[model samples]
Target: MLCQDSAFRLYLDRCRRHKFGLTEAQLPDGTHNEQDARDWICAACSIESRAELDHNLEAWQTFRAIRNRFNRWRARGGA
Candidate 1:
């Protein structure tokens, strides 16, 4: 996933702020194409219920944690 992408980053920020409205389950699955990243942002922008917001936050948290770890590893030359 392109976490650095503006749209994707916005989605992540929205999720962090506890906003969510996506109907489809678009949680990260270790691999994401550009379309998947765009879909995630679209979902964030369309969130319409408390349940979906909560789900988004949960998924985003997990995704962020994993991404952070990967970034740290890469920084340490794990790439």
Candidate 2:
């Protein structure tokens, strides 16, 4: 299930402060394309894009940790 609107709103707000603010790109309709959707949501939530990230970087390897940080921040009302 998707996140609730209230939770999403809070996450969106937090994203504005924390994420790269990437814009959503519209794809063809009915495409089971989850990446675009995921990117859209992450953009909305201000979460960093892991798509083009170079996981070779030491900091990049900490991707999950970054996600956890955002999740924790969301739980804490990251405003």
Ten-residue stretch with the least lDDT total in model 2: 24-33
Query: Residue 38 lDDT in model 1?
Result: 53
Candidate with the greatest TM-score versus the true structure: 1
TM of each candidate vs. truth: 0.34, 0.28
The 0-to-1 C-alpha lDDT of every candidate, in the order given, reads 0.49, 0.47
Candidate 2 structure quality by residue, lDDT tens digits, 1-79:
1223344444544454445554433322233235544555455444565443444354344544555655787688653
TM-score for candidate 2: 0.28
- What is the C-alpha lDDT profile of model 1 across 1-79, one tens digit per residue? 3544544444444343444554324443234455655565445446443245356876566556656755665576544
**Candidate 1: stretches off by over 4 Å:** 3-55
RMSD of each: 12.2, 9.3
Q: Between which residue pairs do clashes occur in model 1?
A: 21-47, 21-48
